[model samples]
Target: MQMLIIGGSGEMGQWFATFFKNEGYDVWISGRRGRSDVAEKLGVRFTSTPEEIIPECDVVIVSVPIDITPEIIRQTAPIMKPGSLLMDLTSIKKNPVDAMIGSAPEGVELLGTHPMFGPSIPSLQGQTFILTPVENRCEKWFPIMRELLERHGAHIEIITPQEHDHIVSIVQGLTHFAYITIGATLKELDFDVQGSRRFMSPVYEIMLDFVGRILGQNPWLYAQIQMQNPEIPNVHRSFIEQCERLSKLVVENNADNFCTVMKDASVHFGDTGAALHRSDKLINAKVAEFEELLQSIGKEKGLYHIYSGKTHVGIVEKVMARSVDILESGKLVNLKIENVRLLNSDELNAWKNDNLAAKTRDISTYIPENADPDTLCHILGKISEGISCKVHDTYISPDGRRSATFRIDIRQDIDINKIQDDIERLLEGIGCILR
Candidate 1:
């Protein structure tokens, strides 16, 4: 199957292109003002525009910015082949779905999809995918697309285009507006966000993370999301009014009335206890990882960069509030705590297998008279993905017990001293003793 994604050079577009390619489709991408370099890196074909290639594609996805999604849909849908699918991955569904219906010919299936997560997400697992499928419009393709997405761990939600917009107005619109407003207000106040972290509690730290996450992304995309959605103005107004009301309450220092307002709002907000529990879990998780880093000082630890997908395996010499200093090959590399995942032992070894040089060692161990030597070797090989074990020799020890020697080939950069105890444990599991 051939799938063409418009705006393929963009973040979400590139993400989908890679996704479809992995699903065995010959993916093609059309970037409006983007270079083909991005498509090349994504291992997908690149086109200058959607017009020339839309008819040839089995699936045409319009993933352009929200402002141009309608126009892009109109231009590409007319040329799409009958029995093929035409879809939009825009945030706002109503306008683009309308355009697809108006411009697409009778047999061309139409679907309006909004992926609630961003490109930064590692996988489809636990991600929400909103589908705005029109009645009698996408009967043939809707089930196929929904099933495919769900099979890969996407949480699919079926809703009308108008309903999607209405919900997203609060979901994306209100939250984004509030966070961006906080960021802008901080700028206006000349407040140092980094310096404020020194005195921040867990809740404050988490809130600052959300604000920074928004402020770091593309401003143009955020602007289009806020400006193009007609329903967002009402949400924004409601949020601002609520903020002003809270401010006025604080200004008047009316303790009884303020408590009444808070109690009413708490009653309206469902599951506050569950929300608090989840937030506590998040805070505890952060503290646990930080504690691990602290314990890893003067030890070989591995940290995987979330965005770059690079693994840094080195001695951890220093740990700060929001950063860590890794002594990698006599060079100190500072990494942000938020931007990296601390690798477990298995993960660290797996990374080393792909990057480090191979080394072989012959290990001899005394086995129990009744224990199977072959089974012990099998267990040893299963210890790590980076190592292979083969039974090399068997002989009698000086004490007259049966003994087996294995040739262990390690392709990972593992410290032999640390792995030696692990090997001894494996041998002892089956009543075997290490030589």
Candidate 2:
């Protein structure tokens, strides 16, 4: 059968077009802009004139914005063939379903559907498709639609239009309200969310991620879902009432009442233990995924501060099959990748500067003398003023000659040979030879 989707430039509409095309139907999409490139990518036909295409299509799905869907249904419903099917993809079903029933031709089938996902989802596996069949004059069309969705692993929930709206009010309305409120509160408080992450527990991090996810989507879509559903106001009122009751308990400092409230909620939810178990598995999976990302960062060639049970700073010289080779304080150290709890670039630049300073002081000289420690310290002190230097202990040779050694540390950007020559000239004047 030929299928046409209005507003097919939209993400959800494009999804439907592609899905129906994959099911061996001749799929075409009509939009205001006539996005031929999008139609080509989705392997469907594109048309700027939908009125010309509506009457020819066996299945017409109105997939426009929620607010515009009713009008689109009214315009196209009368033009559809007598035995053809009509449907809409609207989050709130009652209004669009009513419009289709009132406007569609006498014999055209009407089905209102809401696919509970976005376009980024790869397939319909384990996803839900809520169907509210308003009129099924073509009785076989409903079964065909159900079979097509089921073949692709979609779980179909057939309900009345009123029932769908009522359930979504709680499911989408209450949940999104809580998320949006939390996001706004954080913004109002000017919370330093990234700076305070060091103090966040896993649960807090997950909740923050969820808030981010919600705010990242198109605002109009969320607004439509919250505003278009007639049942949302009651849901919001109930949510606020519960919050007020919790606040009163806190104000009264009534621990017993709070416990009773918690018990009642737990009972209402039911299967608490199973829910906890499932959530624990999800949390563990997230933690493992985070660790794997850290391990991948550790395998990169750069300076990293590794923290397993202890902290060590080094440059990641090489990544081996079973371990990593790090150059730490002029020595190569190997560490197993799995043993690292955190490997970060926080102290990398500081460690690199220190390493460069150490490399500049690579030359060490010893001078043979029989001088007192005080005199040697004084001579070294004078030379130290010109450059960075540290004096070593004196050692007596077999010939009873005493020798002292010192090292010079300089900046990497300076002329190392010129500084060494200048220091040697001063040392020779003090009767100390470079050994």
Candidate 3:
């Protein structure tokens, strides 16, 4: 099967290229610059324009930013062959999907998709891909698309174009705006991350990591996420109003009123049940801190609930020596931990069953392929600026295969080629094979 990736040099585009290439498909990437950077890196063919590549492909997956999605669909529609599928990966669907419906030629299939994760996760092991099929003929391509995604481990969800955008107005649109605003606020405050690390709590560290993460994503992409959807501004308005309510409660020093508001919001946000409470390490540290500060303290264990997913995985009625509030029996335990990064489903389950004390890898020893000691350290410094994976160790085997493991918890939907090519290129520079 031939797959053509419009905007093929983009991060997501590169991800799809690597994915199809790995699956032994004929993958060709086309982009505006006419440059084939991603295809070259993945050792796939590349084209400067869709006109040169579109007719030859069975599937055309457009991975351009949301703002340009409509124009891209218009450009691509006239050129797509009949019976061929044309789909886009834009986050907001209504406009682009509508554009595709209006622009696509007769007998051609049109669909819209949102993979629901960044290129950070390549495997799609547990990620969801939302699909909105435009017409009846589009049904022919749905199973083909689903099969390819499922082969790479993505969960599929089908929704209409309108429903897709309205829901994402909250999930993608609101969330992106909030994170960007927080990142900007931090910059304005001139918050020194280095100094803060000296007194880091798990929660605080996680929040800092989140700020850095959203900040590192493409500025233009984030801007598109903020502006492309018309419903986002209203969501943003509601969020700000809620913030005002919280601030008013704090300023008035009405603890009871604040608590009531929290209860009401909690009831509205139905408990997902899979939330983490405190890691065992965190709880112990908190207890120790309280003991040091107070002369007298209770000696009763706190309630903890372990979660595998939406369902309750395990629960700890007590930890043997610290008094704590027991909320619902099957209620979420870690509902208050902000900026908490997620683990893959399997790792999460393992850690939860083990009571969250699982050993984490230390990244200091990791070396990059053929990188000078100084360069390796610099690369690690750059990587440390973000919240995701970190390199663990780099080694070249006797047979010439070079590899570097990482200390990161991998997400199912992350595009590994983004990093894999870096490693491969580095190894090739050092005259090593991938084996």
lDDT agreement with native, every candidate: 0.88, 0.78, 0.69
Model 1 lowest lDDT segment of ten: 412-421
Please give, for residues 1-435, the per-residue lDDT of candidate 3 as tens digits. 888888888889988888878888899988787776657778999877668788778888889888888998898888888999888888889999888888888988988899899887738999999999886868788887789888878899999988987899998877777878887877799987668767887577656777778888888988887788888889989999999999999999999999999989888877534234445456566555444323222321222223323422333222222232223245534332122222334554444445433223333332335546445435533432122345667766675554555453323223444444554455456554344
Compose the digit string of candidate 1's lDDT tens values, residues 1-435. 999998888889989999999999999998867578988898989888667888889899988889989998888888889999998899999999989889999989999999999998878999999999877878888999998899889999999999999998999898898999999999999999889999999889989999999999999999999998899999988888888898898999988888998899999997899999999999999889999999999999999999898888899999999899999989999999888989999888777877788788888888889878788889888886777888999998777999999888777466665566688777778688777
Error (Å) of candidate 1 at residue 73 is 0.9
**Worst lDDT 10-window in candidate 2:** 300-309
Candidate closest to the true structure, highest lDDT: 1
What TM-score should be assigned to candidate 3? 0.63
Ranking the candidates on lDDT from highest down gives 1, 2, 3
Q: List the candidates' TM-scores in order.
A: 0.87, 0.67, 0.63
Pairwise lDDT winner, candidates 1 and 2: 1
- Mind giving the per-residue lDDT tens digits that candidate 2 earns over 92-210? 99999899888987889988899998887879999999999864454868898999899999999999999999999988889999999999989999999777666877787778878
lDDT over C-alpha atoms for residue 406 of model 3:
45
Clashing pairs in 2: none
Q: What is the lDDT of residue 24 in candidate 3?
A: 82
